[model samples]
Target: MKKTYVLDTNVLLQDPQAIFTFDEHEVVIPAIVLEEVDSKKRNMDELGRNARETSRIIDRFREAGELYKGVPLPNGGKFRIELNHRSFSKLEEIFLERTNDNRILAVALNLHLEAKKENKEVVLVSKDILMRVKADALGLKAEDFLNERAVQEDSIYDGFQEWEVGEEQLNEFYREGRLQIPEDKKKMVYPNEFIVMKNSINPSQSALGIVRSNQQVIEKCWYQEENAWGISPRNAQQIMAFELLFRQDIQLITMVGKAGTGKTLLALATGLMQVEDLGLYKKMLVARPIVPLGNDIGYLPGEKEEKLKPWMQPIYDNLEFLFDVKKSEDLDKILSGIGSIQVEALTYIRGRSIPEQLIFIDEAQNLTKHEVKTILTRVGEGSKVILLGDPQQIDHPYLDEFNNGLIHVVEKFKDYSLSGHVKLLKGERSSLAQLSADLL
Candidate 1:
């Protein structure tokens, strides 16, 4: 049976075209949602962009007929906007104030009554847990907006296991620098599971193995360096990050970190080494969202690149520090080498197929799942895409730790044979940097 879904304001703000996601199911937009959108239209940011886009979408439907009555959508659903005051008949006595949250709840309560009268299942979908609670108090069927949130975080496995192996097994693996187990041995491993082989007799020798398949031990490397780029992978959790970044087979890598984890430096250096030394990829492409962390770049003047100069400066600083170049012009020449390195913005990334290249997306925590999908689908053969950002320091206000696309991809891909992850523990920046991170 086709169900009716009443969308909350936060749902639309999270994704402007969320209505198109529900196939063949009737989508209802309350009038309060429009008012909220209008209020956000003047503001600048992702929310503002979504608000304007939502307005355009609603106006297109208005061409067919009034929003009060349902209009047919391109995909197989009907879209309608509700503005009736009678929706609050039951709750007006208690919620007489015109507060935005109360008004939205009123619209949802009204929809629930109408759906009951017509004997149709009506559910109000929202990202706001409080809104869902309010609907439940009013005796309405309500649920969370699943399109933006993760399935569950409690069950997120780290893709590794610990076991004890015989002394003979350890010597065999060390001599060969790899281990191949029987088909029955596969039962003990997950897709990307890592095994730490501790000597059954000596109790000292141990080796980490990343299970690529039934018998194959995926390529593994060990870094004796205490920390690289102000980050250290110490425990099993940190080891995952090191294994993923050093592997040549797993071409695409995405890492989510807080401020001082050194994600950007690691990604940049890996891209450089891959493109320049290893000859694995043809070129290195570095790009970011151009989203301001604290201040806007609009006040700056000149052409597009000039306007972006301030925002892109941090990336250039990383490159300059990596290459040990002091002059700005010298660094530009290095980047211009037969297009060895291309620093770009997301605006030009669309509609371009990237092949034989290493692409690094810094600050990926701000991107939505749909946007991340678009970027990943554009990757051509022999290309690697690395997304590096911190889930805690997300510049986008709407994106939380679990809900961001970077985390979602990491969680979803942990079970895949081709994917691996690491959470950096020790910060190598400096004593001051580490202390600041802890305090601030």
Candidate 2:
């Protein structure tokens, strides 16, 4: 049966194209949602951009028909902007305040009551978890806008898999440097997926290999035990990360791990090695999202670089370690001496085509899928991009472990040969930190 989906302002801001997602179902945008969207349009961030896009989308629909009445969508659904002129007396008894959320909920509640008279299903779609809870409290159906969710947390690809094989096959793999996976196992593997081949009878005997999807074969990793810059892989996952990071064949590399998994350290070390030692790229560009904890960078009193220092301090710390500079002055001197490295904010990366550069985007979990797409599209010819993040440490309000851009790119590019991903399980920061990460 057809149902009505009431869209919350956050749903539109999270995805501007959310209006078209509910196929053949009525999509209602409350007037208060438009007011909320308009309030954010003047801001200077991704939310403002999305707010404007939402307005433009509605305006395009307005050109076709009266949006207040209803506009016929191409997908056989009707799009309408609802104005709730009804009295808030009932809501006041429950909420006791006429807040924006309560007003939006009023619109959905009114629709639900009207739909009930006609025996029609009505649901409120929102990205706000609390709003959904409120809608449910009011005896209305509510759901999350889930079109952007690429995978569930448990079902997310872990970048590596173990395959049991005969001891002879494992020996043949070591001898010939390649092994043909059986048809059943090949069906389960993806391109560039890390594979640990273990002897069927002896679990201790294992060899690490990567799947070549096109060839239907598993090949040995080239950079096993290899050091990038002065940093050596401390674990098998890090070894896989180093191989993916150093390989010119893989243009994109994504690393997901906890706080102490050396996500940024490995990327910076490999980026320095590629840009300075091997001269593989003309410059090394390191950028990260400026998601602040309390105050934004704009509130800080300093120039752009100085304002970004605190947010970018983690990047500087890794660079200082990689360059072996202990003091602040020495670190500045070393960074100035190496003119090939550029550390900037992700905001400054827009409207520029970066070519012949090795780009490292740190704290990638804090970015939306759209933001990540914009950054990736900025990569010019002969440039390689590495995204480093711990999904569990996401600061972005609308992003989570499964839906963040880091995992989105990891999942989307899993089947492609040009991209590689590694999820580091070990926390090499310290024993205390590792224990805390595990226990906490």
Candidate 3:
């Protein structure tokens, strides 16, 4: 049976090509969806970029057929814009407050009624929680645009593990500085897990084990260069980070952290130390989305780098600390030497192949899953891609803590040896920085 999907404005704004995602199912773009897109066409951030892209996509079809009528999709589906005449009538009664939410809901309700006549399923997709609630009240099937559920913010994993070891085992590990495990530690252990050993009888001999993925056997070379930026791998979170950074096997590292947790700083320091200092990689590259939190950078005069300086300043700050450059001019010299360290926007990253570089994407939490994949696919051989960001502080309105690319990458790649993740907990920025992060 074919399903009919009615997209809200938020859905299109979140992903302009969502019409093609249904995979042979009919997609309905309520007329109001276009109105919302047109209203935001002048936006300068992700929302506006999506609006213009959606307009172009719809315009391509308009050239072939009438948009109000129906156009055949390339992937065995039909797309149409539903103009709700009856919804316009009921708008006053249901949408007495004249809110945008009400108007969008009216479009869905109108589609639901028409779907009932044909005995077809009509599903409305949106990111707004309240819109789905309204659809449920109207007895219509509605869901989040991304089809991703939210995980409790507190329940987000810190990537740490604790284990109670035998008293003799603790003695052996502490005395010999390492211990071998004979049995499988599956349920009690996670891939790339960091374990803290507490003696069942003796408490003073507590030790740590950075578990290797795919097996439980303790390797001899497990604890090399554990201190990263003065933070040791004493807990699971730090161990997870070590597993990603120190390994020659994994090519991708994705980490999530709240404010003051050192996601960007750690990634930059590790990349610089490994690439330039340690001679592990040839060059270091850092990039981020320049999307504004509350405002947009519209029509800025001068070149791209100057316009991008405001957002890329954070990257330079990390580079300054890594190079130990006290003076501003000294840091500029380093940046100039490594022309390989390209500070680029996500837009320019598309349709390019990058090879043999340690690429760090700061503030990755603001990007959508599609955008992240686009950037990742650009990576060539002998390269490591590190994504670091806090999903909670995401500037993109359409994305949330779960559905954003940062979390999606972490969850999807936890099982793969080619990827690793660490959820940093301790904030080492400063006393005041930690307090503000906790209190505010």
Candidate 4:
């Protein structure tokens, strides 16, 4: 059965390649969607980039045939553009407002009626929850655009697992600091995944190890009580994070946790230590997406660094806490003395190859998978990149816990030996803050 899918403006903006995702199914684009996309094309952000890309994709299809009539897509389905001159009388009866959403709905309604004559199904694909609700109220089938969702929230990889083992095996693991995973458990572990081997008879006897899939063994974790830049791990997950962060073998590390779980602090501390103390890298580069909390305050008045001060204040705060500098003047002196740390916005990180640097991208949950790909591809030789964020605190309109770039990288790289991930569960900031995070 051939189904007709009417796409909302957000679907294309969220993913420019969405039109190709529906294999062998008719994809309908409303004229109102093009208007909305055009309105965002002039903005200077990810939305604007996606809007332009969407236009390019649509334009490329013009060589095949007229979009208004229909064009044969590569997937054996048809691509169409529905003009808004159609009658909206049916939709006006339900939704009186003349908003763009209503106009898009009117296009879908017209398509639905025409498809019903041929006994075909017409579905609306959108990322807007309210739009889907209104679509169902109008007796239309609607679904979220989930082609890029790689993992579900509940099924996300926690980077660690527990296995029951014989007492002899457990004791051997503790003594030798390495144990071969039984053939039955080999399929259950991933490269760099943490494991807790407990004695089957005595559950209290356990040993922690990380899977070395290439070596076919589980080795002891590289966790010591030593501090990195005056910051020490306070929990089991934090210890695992340090093991991943300070390792030269791991090129990519992702830390997911709540606000107070020390994700950014630990990353910054380790980056400073690696670049400054150990001279492992040339510099420590920190960057983050500029997604504002509420409405943006518009442009500021200053040069690049001065303009970035407000957005990078949180990064500076973490540095100040690490440096133990209270006065702004003193903090400037200390940072100047170090002369190897550079904090910039994610916008400027594109199109530049960064070599021999320790890069920390905070607030990565606010980025899309495409944006993260761009950032990662810029890493040159001998460079290590760390992405840290709280998936629960995303500010991106189109991103969620499962689809954000941080989680996307974590899940995609779990099987690779050069990547490591840790999800911090406990909040060690303060009792009050922990309670607020739990209750609120």
* Predicted model with the maximum TM-score: 2
For candidate 2, the 10 contiguous residues with the lowest summed lDDT are 290-299
Write model 1 residue lDDT over 27-71, tens digit each, in one string: 998887899999989765567777899999999988988789999
Ranking of all candidate structures by their TM-score, best first: 2, 4, 3, 1
Against the true structure, what is each candidate's TM-score?
0.73, 0.96, 0.77, 0.95
TM-score of 1: 0.73
Candidates 3 and 4 compared by lDDT, better number: 4
Give the 10-residue window scoring lowest on summed lDDT in candidate 1. Answer: 218-227
Clashing pairs in 4: none
lDDT tens digits, residue span 243-334, model 2: 89988989999888888988889888888888888999999988888872122467788797788888788998887787787787898888
For model 3, the local distance difference test gives 0.75
Q: What is the lDDT of residue 34 in candidate 1?
A: 92
lDDT of 4 at 100: 94
lDDT of 4 by residue, 2-79 (tens): 899999999998899999988999999999999999998987677888899999999999999999999998989899
lDDT of each: 0.74, 0.87, 0.75, 0.87
Error of 1 at 186 (Å): 2.9
**57, model 4: CA deviation in Å?**
1.8
